[model samples]
Target chain A: MLHTLPELVNQRTTLVRRGRFLCVDFRLSVGDVDYDITVNHGRLVGFTSDGGLLRSWRFRIAAPAQTWLAFWQPVPAPGYHDIFALNKSRLARLEGDLYPFMSNLRYFKEVIAIPRDFNFTTEQDLVA
Target chain B: MSASLEPIVGRYLRTTWQQRPVRIYFEEAGNGIPLVCLHTAGCDTSQFRHLMTDPAVTDRFRVIAFDLPWHGKSPPPVGWQDEDYALSTDAYTEIIRTFCRDLELVKPVVMGCSMGGRIVLNLAAHHANEFAALIGLEAADHQTPWYDTEWLNRPDVHGGEVCAGLISGLVAPQSPDEARWETLWQYLQSGPGVFKGDLHFYRADSDYRDRTALIDTAVCPLYLMTGEYDFSCTVEDTTRTGAAIDGAEVVIMGELGHFPMSENPVKFRQYILPVLDEIEKKSAPKS
Candidate 1:
């Protein structure tokens, strides 16, 4: 799911329109791994595993890999149903500046749940 | 253009809150016992639109839904520029009590959701004699607050949209797309900060745990119903609330979340109709 996050997001042009004015970077931590992601005008432009200094992001959304696994399921249940739900239940943690995140909330939520919408795992599809 | 008229009527009532002149906007339909609805925090009375328009409900019960001051069509108390709005327990109860008196309603069975839900406990505990029955939807004596209320009110945020976005997940995933968005549209149109102002009572001011044991069900039977999908007021919250109050009845609504009536009126009807029927029966004079 993490590997395909960019593809899954870029494919949904209609969903990205809602946050077309937003341009920011954010961090996603699944287990011990981290991905520094950049979104430009609502499209996921790039992301990398580069660590150390000079990295900046509007916010960081971190949860255990298992938590993300449950969240990415085709049909998550209850607390796993939404990011805010996960945050409320304390299964996931959100830190750093929340301005961009809150201002573009619906877009952010829709973008992150792309995996749920596509349920992608195919390498051929990922190559696209 | 094609348009259909609903039997529902909207009107404003002349009233007062703590010696200040006030006006309340409400919509009503049907003809029997008054079913005054209290909407969730920040949002207004539209949450009960389906119930008010349904013949099954209105044919036998007069349904009334009102916007609390500073919500929907109801404006805040005067002296406009200087005050920050906050709802208190006494103020909330008084608003309902006065609305009833102004309408000349006798023993109206009150049903409220979310903030409306929590306040029912206050009504049950201190003013039970004024109501024939109390129904609390997505209700609990208390639930822990999960977010900073300021986010819903601050200047940098689009209060209405952010507010709607935050709560959209609270609606059941099974609800129809139409009903779900309709519920969100209401939040998108909410007055700035009104949702947070109402929270003054929900998360802080209206904690009913200390007084739950004081409610006498024999006076006004209390009913607790919560959606299975509501994390804010989980089933456990309502269950624990029901247990604390003797004779309180609890029901868990399936495939529904916090905003039951508004988000999925079709499914909510299945759960609420029986309860409404029981209330109708209870109010019927003995033969």
Candidate 2:
């Protein structure tokens, strides 16, 4: 049971209910660093850097640190505004099974776009 | 009476195009020279919901938006069960022409976005003498499609969710949450395989590159405005298209994307009102 997913998913009761059917885990890479992203029933449980090699993920969405920085901005630029746009512009690379990615596309989009409040003055801080 | 009526009125019109008769559902508001609106692929008359209600426009222009068959509120033409709905350029052109003639709109201004945008170029190329002007929003001669549309129709995924999800990115992040989600809601309401079916026109059937040189803006003014954030029809695409047409007016709107009118009507109005005003002046009786 997802006791805390509501709070995690914008505290929206509706999303919390809908999240029940969603279960996806993936790896997000910014530069050389890899962050294991887990979405258990629609809740973005966590995205922590350094997933052990033994851990498995369905897909990997990788981008340059600068691309991640541009995307995380409260208001992103034209080409960097969307994951698909990034992939289209070759600013980001999405690999592995796209089935899961397309299956819960909205969930993946919203979860990734939850907007990080982190204040990073440089690509180094973002990668850190 | 707590039930106040909106100024808009809904109605049905019958028109036959390409030997195929279809019942079209259209909504209208305001009163003046008819301004026929064409919505983006997979969307319907609802995209013009805000445009119809805006008094600034309604006072001078009669805004009318119609749903294509197999789209919102409009059912497919009879005998559709055996056919897959594919909107060809010839069919789309004839539909608008027949619709305008049936409605008795005298030289109505035709404005459209996306696939609708592509067709206006065809309209100008072949039928400029019949209309007052042409406005193409998020238009281009051509742009390679960014994503495969197969994901939108597959049984493995929820069709509505996938369609709305893919389209959500096309709306600019600067758009208000209310307007943005409402735009997605419209996509969410699109029928099964309908969005993909419409892509038959947008992704495959419509390419105006070779045809742009044939459009003569002298017969009817052509205005091409594209939102800055529309990756699907990039600013470069609109500008290149504009350059190909000698006298076309080109504009790059800021902080908006593919579905400019639906996703950010307020901002779209700021850019569009001026064009409408210009059109009114162009059509005014010379004294």
Candidate 3:
């Protein structure tokens, strides 16, 4: 069970390869906690929990923990289906340089979706 | 079990009403009467990729779509940074005029969605002489109150993500996963602030409530079809707009959304085919 997004990205080689040309950096804000991630030459080179905001990053996608839980499901519901859907409904926020985020949208979307394959569990839905 | 036919993709350079050099990207497929398609705002000509390839549609119509000046493969006009890139009625109408004239599409059937939908009505009102008919998908006279543009333009807000999020809501609730995802992907790939720029026209600049009277359907047939899930341009809203225009046809598409043409092309085609058939029958040579 992959517990964190950083760990999930590092393990997904194919996903990383799919985004090799996306030599940009972005952050994912899960609830109040922020994870700084970097994709360099199609490799997941940096995945760290930053204490402060990484202002230099191309974009920062922030959503509530509950929103992310629904989104990461193998099959997501209406509001959780797409990151932009969340933004439309005011459930999530995307801030910073939008060009890189828009231009390389598919690469980042797949990269974020990698964790869905991992059977991770939180206290809310832990089977064990 | 589908036959594949590729569209001829090309670029056209034109000096738009904005007096800037703009490269408009376009795609064309099939033959027969010309049918020029306009993409939703913030998206490019690629939204019609599947429609252009559909043999059923292509056999009787020459389908064409073009990227607006700043959307898709077409970059912003020179000195774009100096002025805010809000899509005005004049600029929007002029681009369409120049595009059709440049291509020599005699009496083409014009179709559009969302922002494109709104503009086609304007095209009918002012330039009815140019087109044979007008098809407006998700067309409305005013923007819904739910569309909040302030936060979307904030400096810290990621324009792309929020744009995708907001626009994704308009996709039909039952749209195919691939089709829905592909529609959202267009918003994700749009140029920075392009969606917002387009919305400036969609939300505030493009109200046709009073002006709808000017749309003479006899001059150019008017048809408005809105998706059931298009909360922004709900069926009621579209019907209200259609009621204002004389001889305008109105339709409500079940299981479709604001981005119906792209979100579910098959369903959209089903709705559109009958309308096209009617147009062809009416326009057929009177023996």
Task: Return the top candidate by lDDT.
Answer: 1
DockQ, candidate 1, vs. native dimer: 0.69
- What lDDT is reached at residue A44 by model 3? 71
Estimate, for each residue in A44-73, the C-alpha lDDT of model 3 and write its tens digit: 777766546535677899887778777777
Task: Give the per-residue Cα lDDT of candidate 2 at B2.
Answer: 90
Give one digit per residue, the lDDT tens place, for model 1 in B1-287.
89999898999997998788988999999999999999999899888999999999999999999998898898888885577788899899999999999999999999999999999999999999999899999999999887888999888889998999999889877889999999999999988788888899888798888999899999998899999989899999999999999999999999999999999999999999999999899889999
- Please give the DockQ score of every candidate, comma-separated: 0.69, 0.79, 0.08
Interface RMSD for each of the candidates: 1.0, 0.7, 5.9
User: Highest TM-score, which number?
Assistant: 1
| Regions of candidate 1 where Cα sits further than 4 Å from its true position | A50-54, A120-128
Local accuracy of candidate 3 as per-residue lDDT tens digits, B124-224: 88889888889998888775656456645557656776677667657765799999989988887777778778888887788877688888898989899
Distance (Å) between predicted and true CA of B248, model 3?
A: 0.9
Top candidate, metric DockQ: 2
Question: Any residue pairs clashing in model 1, and if so which?
Answer: none
Q: Report per-candidate TM-score of chain A alone.
A: 0.84, 0.79, 0.80
Q: Clashing residue pairs in candidate 3, if any?
A: A20-A42, A84-B164, A84-B165, A85-B165, A88-B166, A94-B158, A95-B158
Tell how far residue B249 is off in model 1, in angstroms.
0.6
